[model samples]
Target: MDQISLALLSVFFLLVSIVWYSWIFKNWTKKLPPGPRGVPILGYLPFLSHNLHIQLTDLARKYGPIYKLWLGTKLCVVISSPSLIKEVVRDHDAVFANHDPTVAGLVATGGVDIVNSPYGPHWRNLRKVFVREMLSNKNLDDSGPLRRYEVRRAVRNLYGKIGTNVDVGELIFITEVNVVLCLIWGGALEGENRDKIGARFREKVAKFVELLGKPNLSDFFPILAKFDFQGIEKEMKGVLPSVDEILNSVISDRMKIMEDSGGEFSSANRRKDFVQILLDLMKQNDIVIGGTDTTATIVEWVMAELLQSPHAMQKAQQELTQVVGLNNIVEESHITKLHYLDAVIRETFRLHPPLPLLIPKMPSKSCTIGGYTVPEGSRVLLNVWTNYKDPQVWENPTEFKPERFLNDDDNGKWDYIGNNFHYLPFGSGRRVCPGIPLAERMVTYLVATLLHSFDWKVPEGVKLDMEEKFGIVMKKSTPLLAVPYQRLPSLDMYE
Candidate 1:
């Protein structure tokens, strides 16, 4: 070997050691919030979990409101308190509105959809279309019949399973899929028809979600992000084709529906599902990825909690029976009268928010949070699970008490949205779930109808397992097994 080559190698090694020690002992030690100690360069990546929501919530209890976590080369600061969450996600909303360009987001939104779009004119337009056509109140009202029809179909299925063990997760997943499909394609899946439009939509949506939140080394290290070292691109490559096929077929079908009617579908007198409006957008601004995942997650969590909390379930059922009697189907009109059911749904959202660390919020420029200086592009996470469960904000925070929401003084004040930030399941800000109203309707109607028409109980030997398995959303660790009995004969629920 040459003498100069050895000399240059020695110089490089010395500089690398100096930088590594500087990040740990000098630069990061004082600036970053308190967190577990870790080795050089790698940091705390090994200490993290696949279900980061649960992991972060535990850490927040130990470390306080703001805590630091390192993923590969970058430092991520998580905010769990409501005051900081409001200050960051609202007051400085625009500053932290940009996405972190993670592989999960890129794959989920097809890298161009509204949910993943960079903060700019394109994102603004996409949000407008989502709110105006896809998620507008007028459209929700127009699709009320479709929702009612789906709810009836679900009730029939539940009734048939009376006295027999059933996997409620599979039942609810299929039911929610049909609800989304009817809204997406204007139809439902019938028995033995495996290749139906609804089935196709579910298949595509499932593949997209399964791949979206999977970990990727590229996300943590930008220099390797484009290279796709962890085969994230391969997984996405397999998912995108199915997603495109489903959307494209729906696009074509909507064109036919319009032609047959000799006019464009009206929000007042139209199916007005997601796909129909998506086709009309001209540019196909964003994939409807969030629609399926977010909705499915909400449904799953709502059902899981209902199955676990029998008293809460019975209270909802009692209200549902009174509001929607036997022989009658639950309608949009019934949603308002089922107050207990609404409270149950709200409790589910509070305890198990779909996106634990809502789409990572990045600062547009350097800023100060909790007395610490954060640089531009530093990734920030709103640890919603922590905020929702904070004992200081909620009474008996750990208990699943739906009655806490019932007003005691008869003043009729619903404290769901108030000053203390007790609930932010849909988040709060310019980027709040645009699908909030639609989600609320589906959850309310489905819960009210299911509880109204059937009595659900866990199997003989099996206790309702409340352990959570985290995905992009928190889900039940084990699928719920319940025997749904026909509504008590005197209840006349299905009359």
Candidate 2:
């Protein structure tokens, strides 16, 4: 038995050596980063785990912060450290400005839209419309009333559910969905119709985001994409039509309203970017999905973290009570003055980055990062999750401590502009989230209102689950279910 086992072990080592040397020799001239070798047909594909983000971060431990792995035929590189991230997002921004979308992603966006558009004029135009028009300071400020209406509705609705368990994620999802629809097409759909549309959009978005993260054989083995062995593409394509129906209805309604009002309802007369956003269905679709889900997931997470850490929750509530006051409801105007609450939001972002790996970037050309040659079009995953939780970067990295950010505040050093590589919750670069203006006000105000108007309590002594389920957008695996009771001075304030 011993003799046969020894001989087989020797043979296995010999075979692995042959494969490893073959891979090295094939790309010897490029000087690629070192990585594990896999079977001939599926290179490191079978070995990939469900949570790709966590798996890649773990891989960084064995290999350096920046290393490469072959996913079937795709050469995927992962960057974990801040210095390497700085190189990719900052120094070589243009070279890696392009997005490397998955097959499901391509089907979802139709290869057009600001998030997944090719790095060129078309993308620039979309960004221009998005930034200079759709999300301008003036447009966002004017739209404050729209957002306020939806968020306050949620607060009042929760007030009605006093002492009863409520699903926080569902509550926030519906509110954000309605808020985005308001901005997308003001008063276009309302009453039972708006509620019906929101329900459909919520289902479609959950399916789409789930598909976006699923490992497609087509992505790893491009040749298999047409076949769609997993049917991921078909399912993704199926998801879009329902979304299009919703978008189409909104467009048709808005157009009818315009004609009825003698064309006074044009972008020029109102939001100023409706026409541009309407022209591209995918752009509007991305906005709806990205806008609703990211904000809701973040709000749920902040609540979960605060629930578990009573000290942080009490401190945040105390700050909110002092700043926002019991006589008035939480408002966007109160966001800046709630410094401790701001720290709590920053701390939550640090812990639960909305997009764990900010939309994978593909280099426009072969480039060098961390001194290793990253080939053109290779899927380069920026492991920002690792950077956020790195021991060297933060003290007690895994612990939930908001005070860490407040202790060393210096001239906007910890802002979300992605300037601070150590903490880019929304992301950073030429393609930094254009919706920042709206997201900041929405996320902060929602959390502030909930905390200020009512005190949150976890269901019946159950421990709050902080476990995360990773996708392109990371969310709490277990949805937060809690009760809320009035903390304000009067019920009239809610009205």
Candidate 3:
């Protein structure tokens, strides 16, 4: 045969072999979960809505609680049922402990940060640093003055702008960013440079968050990753340098201090800031990203819910008045006593989880969930939003009713700690968000202070809009613009 005929024969044999191989495996391979049919190549990508959580929930109604989809060549399975979620996150936790980092995630974290790192000794070390060394109760308590200072500063700023429109989300984001910066390196920077660094860090971090969540063709199609069809990865790389520059400067300055101080920088004389502790450990990207974005996003969501539901707002205020008293400002010690405020926060999480689909997981090995075999390396999404709003699981799931969580029975049933499968706002299992303790403290304290110090209402002639915009974090589509009035008896409280 001629060369052209030989090439054609080779191609035919390859195709035949692939078909025969697939056929032979089909009989023994476990069945995949049910899902909607899709067009070839593109799969379900075309049908996806910008608000993916809502669209996926709608699909769940048709395909049952557990379903699968193909985004480009990637296989994705979404689980909305509590039982199935428990199986993946609890029963077989080790099997699905690995994360399937997106293109932006890999680029942003360099695949080493706790959020994206695979489950193993490295991840364990990082978690230990975060839990025992950095975010320990002693550490958080030591940083209380810093958190209080930032929150009070924000209150004073808003008090000055009372009766005028204020973007609540922006205000809270700035406050949370400053607070996180303080927690990270409050003792490192001083005076004007502190403000400048906080502002610069905020600007860069915002860009980083946007780039991380923006849809990328590379994420869905691994073959096209190097090409970066959408330029998302390239843009992420551009933003990453600014963030790294800041982290490197902080690390270098701290290391120099340690070196110059010689033996004086021993454990007994160590600083309380997280940056000092993490100077010799891993990079601070995970701490910065997790500490700032998630806390700020949830605070914004809770404020939005409270603004939309006046009764809920009044109830929270009353609780604050009773617990902390109008004469006294909110303190970290008071958070535990404010049960109603805690319930309101829980209700907000139910309605709008910061990560609707908790960081996607990858099966380290083939596993069974809900009796269907989930192939190794397939992307698994835990739809916390859908599960939280399941009508069978919650009464009036769409309604913003904090009272539902007021009862001890309900409080025991749901929490951010990821115990109960039905309500996993902070996620569940081995890879569950390690920032939960810090998140709860920051969110509750901020919300309590905001509500106790001021009364907020939608601007005159304006209506509250709770429409959600989907991204890595769920945000209010229209930034909440509200007018604040001093609720405290004395202006001294603002100071």
Candidate 4:
């Protein structure tokens, strides 16, 4: 053969050999589990729907609750059945407690924040600091006056909107944000400070949610993970610095207050809000970025759901009236007495969990769940949304029925606290939401207070749409718009 021909042949053979080796190695790694077949390199990335959770849910209906899918260099096992979900999140929680170390999560969590930190000494120490400083019942009680004050303000603001149509979602967000911000800051904003603080918070939160929730094709296609395929990087880069500044400034301001007045009254007896406690812990190298973010989202979703379900709203109102009485305003202390209201909140959470799939839970060690071997370091999803809607455990799971939880015997003596895999709104095991007690009180208080304060109705000629779109939380498909009519001046609130 000619020299030129021999050279070309040598090059072609090398190329063929490389491709053959790559293909063989890919299949060798592909022996994990059953899932939709994918093209080389992409590995289900192309077939992935925009809303991955919904797509996974539909796939679960056909593939069974426990199935596998490949995301880039990672193998993910999704747990959709309550029984298996319970096994992973409750029975064997330690093995599945790590947070997936995606680029965005690392950037947001500061590599040490409690939410994304791996389950270890650092997480344990941070949890101790959190539980002692912020999550304690004393702290919750200390913050009660602030919460009640905000609730009163929110109730009054809603009352002012009587006879007029307003975006109830936005209004509720504003109210909830004020409550959280007040709990973070020393007190609620007033006049121009209110607008400024509210605007800054809204802007920061919107930017964060938008940047965090978008599809990171890179997450599934590791080769392209740096591509920031959806402009998430560009948006986050522009927004995060400003967000960090806002948070840091708040922290610094609180520290300055502590420095200026060296006394227990300033550091100890002073009103300790969530931010102040976090600030104190920041001195010990502990902090969290998504704390306020999740709180805001949960409150937003609860309102969105309640606004859409008027029957649920009416029932909650009836319960509030019975317990709180027609002449008295609902308070946080009244929540336990309002059993129906609590059930309604639980039902809402079931239908629309704040974190539908939950921040991905990673396994620290290899484990078998539902007959599928999940290798160590696999990204695991609890599939809270699917579990809550499972027909096997819940009768007519899709329907909104608060009564299902009204009594332990209603669903044959179902115990919600430890319902195995059937329901997990706040997750399970050691990782169950530390904020549940606070979140529950806040939700029940606002819900009961609103029901007692006004009569909300779908605006004339407008129907409530229950469609949902997921962000940080699953939000209503349409912004909930309601025309609340003023009722008789019966709910007597304190000054």
In order, how many clashes per candidate? Answer: 6, 0, 0, 2
Off by over 4 Å in 4: 1-31, 226-229, 266-269, 283-311, 410-419, 490-495
Which regions of candidate 3 fall more than 4 Å away from where they truly are? 1-29, 190-192, 263-271
The models' CA-based lDDT, in order, is 0.69, 0.84, 0.83, 0.69
Per-residue CA lDDT of model 3 for 243-322, tens digit only, reads 88878877787677678788356563364677766764657587887788777788888988888888989999999999
Positional deviation of residue 134's Cα in model 3 after best superposition, in angstroms: 0.9
* lDDT tens digits, residue span 334-432, model 1: 888877777777777777777777777778887778887666766788887887677776788877777766666733443333334546776667666
Q: Tens digit of lDDT per residue, candidate 4, span 72-165?
A: 4557788887778778877788898887856665555566777768899888887887778786889889889888877787777766677998
**Model 1: which residue pairs collide?**
113-286, 326-492, 326-493, 326-495, 327-494, 327-495
**RMSD of each predicted structure:** 4.4, 5.4, 4.1, 5.1
CA lDDT of 203 in candidate 1?
66
- Put down candidate 2 lDDT per residue, 1-495, tens digits, no spaces: 699999987785576556646755776899798888777656798898867788888889999898988886688888988889999999999999999999998888878877889989989988887777767888788778788888887777787899999999988898889998877677555677777778778888999999998888888867558879899999998888898887777777676777887867755436433543555544357877888999999999999999889999999999987887778888899988988888899889989998988989999998999889998879998888988788887989999999887865464999888898888887788989988988888899889988998888898978778888988889988889988888988989777
User: Model 1 — TM-score against the truth?
Assistant: 0.86
Local lDDT at 390 for model 3: 72
Clashing pairs in 2: none
Question: Where does candidate 2 stray beyond 4 Å?
Answer: 1-26, 266-276, 280-283
The TM-score measured for candidate 4 stands at 0.87
**lDDT for residue 228 in candidate 2, whole number 0-100:** 95
1 or 4: which has the higher lDDT? 1
Model 3 TM-score, 2 decimals: 0.92
